[model samples]
Target: MSDNVTFDAIVLKELNKPLELVKGIQFPDLKKGQVLVKIYYAGLCHSQVMEARGHRGQDPYLPHMLGHEGTGEVVAVGEGVTKVAPGDHVIMTWIKGSGHEAGGCCYAGPSGETINSGGVTTFGEYAVASENRLVKKPEGIPFDLGVLLGCALPTGAGIVLNDIKPEKGATLAVVGLGGIGISALLAATTFDPERLIAVDIEQSKLDLAKEFGATHTFHAAHDDWEAEILALTDGKGVDHAVEATGLAEMIERAFNVIRPGGGELVFASHPKAGDVIRLDPFELIKGKQIRGSWGGSSKPDRDFEILADLFRQGRLPLRQLLSDTYTLETINEALEDLENRKIIRALIKISEPPADAA
Candidate 1:
């Protein structure tokens, strides 16, 4: 093993600030039941941007590393470990402290202690993971794909497939067609829907949504969205609406466009802290549901492999969902693409050694 090896990592040096490349992080002495993973790929998710913008939290604490979607091989393990061994490829799912589930406020509450305790500190070269935290990467699945399964796909698909479970041939709508929204669209493809509508502020994303399985694509900023969605459903309203943008207004709109007894899935984390959304009680009384999905309510160890198999069989076309790729050093540019809606699915490429291992 290479002792005292150092590597560069993008870090959040201040709250509401830009990320900077830094070096010289000391590898922690592995404690019992912990494993050290040499990160090969890390996705720059919107949540990380929230953290950088001080939306996840405020300063002093703001300076900590901020990456949750991590995939790599275990290089070392501490005493009493058994889930995975050194050299085993794995995906890191974010669930801090302790929690039985990954998505939803209830599941997220228990994780507060963990996130508060230390897991928020992982956007570095080598990340410390619990034995159960790492899910084995499937054969032939690229590291980029592995990291996405940990959160993006599961969260997106999990919301529709796991949480909302829209009825077969039911009309559906998804707002904010970014990573999560795109995954939701892909997930919609598996289950035949009467109508699948994709909504985003950008026309480029709306265009991409069609490729992901959307039957109709519309700009959320346009005045005709509600009318258009209703018109598509024959004015009956959709059976389910998924809010993936994390904006309060969009979530409220999702509630409005769904029919009585329809389901709404909130998948995005809000851009600002303490942002409140207003809703009417009559809507809920009519059997309308508003729910938050965490990592798509994914049980990674069990569901990820199932999803991987689907990907391999061509049931889920993950390749089409990916629109851009970036190297670790060029992370900001990748994120800029995300901000500009130039790309729907973006993966940060970890410059790897030759395909044949040493």
Candidate 2:
């Protein structure tokens, strides 16, 4: 196979520091179960922020790459790969799909040092990810919006559609209106929930959630969100709650906000290490349920098709969900905007979409 591809990528050289946009990073030969992707667009999520700010604990891979969800085209595939072929439009995700699950790939840094990368990283113009890290982009899905399927949809919507399976007229609330929370909120609406409440510290996010079919919106900056949510449920509580912030307190809050006797809370947050959540033993005894999700327990091959159909039917308002866009060079700024709650989901434009893709 041809082996001459050098590209630019952002590198996290130190924890709690800005990432460097190193140029002309050379690529090595693809290994077994690896797929070389010419990235077009990538989505920014809080997990990247946690890594950059040292929120997710000590980083052994300090000089590693960042980002997990992106949309691109397959440039080449390693041996034993059967999932996708060259020129196939695909969504790169951290969630594993049906393919060979390779370990990490090593890239030649600008200074000739080996830079570590996980199964997938999209903060670059091109990415070398495992075969299982991608799914064929379904027809009718735009290149940019594919980022949602990579992480947000599978995690957020997966919690409701795959895990919770809330019945029609079921009362539900989603706290922390990031990409994942909004995706869950959008999916929850299809169930015809009695109360689809959206909670976030930002009024802008809450406002957008309202437009996306949230029956009620709550501002989390105040101290009364739990009380207000309880009042909305008439002191009973919601049938289900999905928390996405990954904060320990918020996870605990979502747990407390649900009603007893089968109230369910599925949180997708990965809070800082050493952070402990204190919960009352009585809640568990009262039949309240809580479960942590691993990518919403999704099997990408099946779930992405369903979500893409939702978007095709004009049910998933992805245009509104894609809050803003930034270039690869400004990826740090994009991540900062997400951390500050300035945007819901930030899109990183790595390269222009193929003209024929339109």
Candidate 3:
């Protein structure tokens, strides 16, 4: 790869419009402790869709780059870069800290609005990430699987083992069976939850959720959804409910479906400010609690390795969750597929970047 190379990137010039191919943006030169990654796979995430639609209430810097889950091989390194070599496969995570220690959530550039300040962390053919922010992929883990540990897997697993921590033989309900909902279902199985109830508007997604480990499924968009969830739990309500849809009505219902002393975990981040959900205060008095989680409260250095081992053993279904792939030039099409629920996950493949020139 040459130092003077440039690559085509899908860029959002304005909120609420289709993306366009933009060329001639120079890949950032590596700085100290930074490595230049030749991105091979970038996961299309809901956050990117939210940002493009202006659903992100926070003021996102305009002309923003859009992507967070990315994986590739290091093609170049700056002075003192040591964690990865030129050919080592790597996954880029949102966790950023100085030196080798993971720090509180901080991003390095103009596109960091999805996670923090400093915009433009990802969404390019090549990205400059700190050496510490990357975890080397095991010999056989493909780039697509590796990218997930950075966010989705940990968030879903954390909701089960950390937030809900469903006790043995407990009954659990997962609302919004999207990417994260499906993952929560699998994680809940590790605890041997007596009944894993999955709820989603689309029956196809619910059917897919059942294949992934959901013990029961319900149509949330139906008028009698609350009654159906209660009936599934045998009228006692579930011991745990996870709200992954990030909608206030869904969040409220998660509370309603939990047993008197059960717990609720809210994993999705809402876009609008002050979106309100009504819930009875008496439930709090009775020990029903709703908690918020970030990145599954994960330390990537440790949690990522654990997830990798699971992926290696096939205990965690990585590839099964993916539905489609596209080139950056077809990002709009990819997003449309996602919006229509045509795919569970869509990944963008960047191919044949120009060689760096002197």
Candidate 4:
């Protein structure tokens, strides 16, 4: 528990290439509004994949850390910190919260190189995070399950519960069954949509969506999937649509499924760089609104508690969220699994959990 901590981490030294695991990297001393955390469980997201593959464009921050969501124990706190203290279990998130904004950190690499880090990076054994990026983990939620609260739940559930705010018995459809898609589908069921539709290329995910309260399911593998949805809605469209896949065409398709009058579309997915989504200008005339969601426009300090309560009450089926688990050494495998669509969410275990927590 000293300022000179050495740990292993996944660093993106080159874009569109496998991340490098640099061991014995020296962590810098915590600055004002900073907190040092021993990372336990982290979630692998498509955002990291976007950063690693240079899909989001530009790589001025190469050899930097990757990961914006995870769970960890606060080992120490820096000056002017008040939100959380040392030894308090907390959730690591990219969503800014109520605390100081200590900027990114600089670490001394093994070979005299420097590794840049953001206010919150979780793909390592330890993290030096900004105090505003940390939120107290509710005791009712285990560390493994709490990891989802960092990004997936906030963005996924936040979209339906916060932005769209569909009325009871309304119609809704969630396209794509990845972490965010599945989370949106799970949250949409709470509203009791008259026709809660789920769409995905994989039958397994479609079947799983049904178990989580989707009234109807569609396979996007078919060319006429959108037409089928329109048919199901009697030539109309759902009141709201959530596009969770980061494909430009899918976002446009999701927008098309929205009803003309006062229909809304919210997408949480991020398409690759230079990917443009073209929409018919006439849709706007029809009262069809579309907007991109930045972490579901979530306020983590207030939302995490509400989300945690839902999880405790069994309303959120988060126990089954993670599709697979991997160690830090197998980080590449985790990313590959995510890219291949083999898993909904991959849990990266930087350090082993305690006996009871496991």
lDDT of each: 0.70, 0.90, 0.71, 0.90
lDDT string, candidate 4, 67-132, tens digits: 999998888899999999987889999999899999999998998798999999999999899999
Pairs of residues clashing in candidate 4: none
Ten-residue segment with the worst summed lDDT in candidate 1? 102-111
Write down the RMSD of all candidates, one decimal each.
5.5, 1.3, 4.9, 1.3
Q: Quote each prediction's TM-score.
A: 0.88, 0.97, 0.87, 0.98
For model 4, the run of ten residues with the poorest summed lDDT: 349-358
**lDDT for each residue of candidate 1 in 1-358, tens digit (9 for 90 to 100):** 3364555556666675567656655455566667777777776667766666677555554335557776787889878777778888878777432322212110011112212213422355666666666777876677766777767888888887788777789888888887788888888878899889998898877877787678998887775798888887777788888888868877887778888765554555564777888899988898777777767778777788778988888877776666677766677777677666677666766656227531
Query: Model 3, stretches more than 4 Å misplaced?
Result: 1-4, 58-60, 96-120, 352-358
Candidate 1, residue 210: Cα displacement in angstroms equals 1.4
Where is model 2 more than 4 Å wrong at Cα?
A: 1-5
* Between candidates 1 and 4, the lDDT winner: 4
Question: At residue 201, what lDDT does model 3 achieve?
Answer: 85
| Residue-level error in angstroms, candidate 4, position 63 | 0.7
> By TM-score, how accurate is candidate 2?
0.97
Candidate 2 Cα lDDT to native = 0.90
Displacement of the residue 325 alpha carbon in candidate 4, Å:
0.7
Which residue pairs come into collision in candidate 1?
97-114, 103-294, 104-294, 155-295, 155-296, 169-194
Q: What's the residue-level lDDT of 184 in candidate 3?
A: 76
